[model samples]
Target chain A: DAGITQSPRHKVTETGTPVTLRCHQTENHRYMYWYRQDPGHGLRLIHYSYGVKDTDKGEVSDGYSVSRSKTEDFLLTLESATSSQTSVYFCAISGSGDGLGFGYTFGSGTRLTVV
Target chain B: AQSVAQPEDQVNVAEGNPLTVKCTYSVSGNPYLFWYVQYPNRGLQFLLKYITGDNLVKGSYGFEAEFNKSQTSFHLKKPSALVSDSALYFCAVREKDTGRRALTFGSGTRLQVQP
Candidate 1:
């Protein structure tokens, strides 16, 4: 939770290759998210970005795809990798510009294992 | 399209006693609640939020939350229990004005805490 950062904390791909998961932040916080934590589906939202190219789609956006040109980087791509997309993948950041509920700052996950 | 419900996927306390981890939400207009905590791989953190006045909102370690907008629920309490306070617990929602603030989680609740 220190400025957010998630990148291959652990990975073991194979399914169909093509996999990218990276989210970096320096607390610029303008909202950037990409969640995926299975096990009864506790965390969905497959994509989110509020600026720097602006993004959308959530609620498990298809096979997942995202990119936030700049603004602290936010990329999550799984073009192929399957096996139900493995699990544990979280990257969150919120608009903590002193407004809008302030509650989000996660990044310590990225346990993808799509054997 | 905002929804969150952690109808007990797991909850069992013992330690010092007192503990409740339940959450319910369904935003449509006014709602910006949250409570996150994940340990054992780590990712989610932010412990409290209720973006308006105070229906009981304290956070961090001695967690607290109770923003029941007429039973929409936002339960997450801890009076004593501490077995290191178990882990995994999340409940989120956002819909104040719904310009797509991105936040709608709830599919987690696993707090053992037994000693």
Candidate 2:
């Protein structure tokens, strides 16, 4: 968990504004992920990256997008913020290819509020 | 589709009493199960994981989970509960053969330890 860091620890923006949350890692893990934590949703995957410049959508990827230009950096962007998008965003990394399982180490999380 | 289910939305147990939080999964082939805990205003912390060679996996903070292959369940348990043990718990799963390493998390179960 210490190796992962998420930027914008707390943010408040008006609806329709664009916002981006950054996740940086020092572990050089090949698999990086972005998840949103909501009341009943637990942690839903918004997007994930398998490698540099290779990303895919998750179950709740409608209003979100991700980019992984480097192995250590994974960014999640909201094209236009909405009230429904206000939730705590978490970034996770997996090094299973390095010989562990699918268990991930998560960043502290970024709390976003849209008014 | 691979998914995890945490039947109880909230579980309350008295201090010093045994506690259990139920979780079940549906996935193809052998599954990798994981448990995570989230304290207030923080990201998730890895508790334990069930990869192989162990039906009962012990994790941090005196928490343990029983992996029942036949029942498709991995319920978290603690012999004696503490007030500080109250937190939001999550169960996640990923198929071993899936290329994507991101886990699918359940709705989550809140454990409330009463004094």
Best by lDDT: 2
Tens-place lDDT per residue, model 2, A43-99, is 999999999999999999998888999899999999999999999999999885633
User: How many residue pairs clash in all the candidates, one count each?
Assistant: 0, 0
Candidate 1 positional error at B53, Å: 7.0
TM-score of each: 0.34, 0.97
- Report the lDDT of model 2 for residue A76: 96
- Candidate 1, residues A1-115: lDDT per residue as tens digits? 6877888799998998899999999988888888889888888888899989989888778887898999999999999998999998988888857433666778988899999
Ten-residue stretch with the least lDDT total in model 2 chain A: A94-103
lDDT of 1 at A48: 91
Clashing pairs in 1: none
Model 1: residues with Cα > 4 Å off, grouped in runs: A1-14, A17-35, A38-44, A47-56, A59-79, A82-85, A88-113, B1-14, B17-31, B35-54, B57-76, B82-87, B91-95, B99-114
The residue-by-residue lDDT of candidate 1 on B15-35, one tens digit each, is 999998989898777898988
> Candidate 2 at B107: error in angstroms?
1.0
